[model samples]
Target: MTTAPADATVRVRYFAGARAAAGIPEETIRLAAGATVRDLVAELGSRHGDGLTRVLTACSFLLDGISVRDHGITLVDGSGVDVLPPFAGG
Candidate 1:
C-alpha cells in the first residue's frame, strides 16, 4: 500500500451491504496527495478484505454528494465519499 502524507484524508461512508462488509458505517482513509477515487477503493479493498472488495464492485459512489462513475477521478482532501451498494426492489 502507498503511504499518504499526514494531512491527506478521505472520508468514506458505507451503506447497506457495503456497511456490513466494511463492519463500519464510516471511516477516514489516509491517502497519498492527489490520490484518486480508484486509489481509495484499492486501499479500502486491501484493508477490509474480500467482502468489501466484492461489495465495491457492485457499488456506486458519491464524491461530496455528487455521483461519480469514474474511479479515476481525483479526490480532494477532506472529501466525503459515499459507498452505496445496490438496493433490492420490492
Candidate 2:
C-alpha cells in the first residue's frame, strides 16, 4: 500500500442535496497533501456514512472556483472545493 503524504486543509462547501446529506453547509477537511478529489470523496464517505456517500457519487465539484472534471486532480493547501449534488429544475 502507498503511504499518504503530509496533511493539507481544504474548505468544502456543500450545496443543496449535498448540504442536506452532510448536515452542514461547509467544513474544513484535513487530508494528504497530494490527495486527489477521489481521495477527498472517500474521506467524506467514511465520515458521513451512506447518505452522504450516495449523494457524493452523483455530485460535481469545483476546485478553487473551476469545474473539476477529473477526479485525479490533486488538491493543495487552502484550496476551496464545492460539492454540488444534482439540482431538480422545472
Best by lDDT: 2
Per-residue lDDT of 4-23 in model 2, one digit per residue for the tens? 66677999999999999999
Work out the TM-score per prediction. 0.89, 0.90
| Local accuracy by lDDT, each model | 0.91, 0.93
Scored by lDDT, model 1 comes in at 0.91
Question: For each candidate, how many residue pairs have backbone atoms clashing (under 3 Å)?
Answer: 0, 0
Candidate 2 yields a Cα-based lDDT of: 0.93
Give the TM-score comparing model 2 with the true structure, all chains together.
0.90
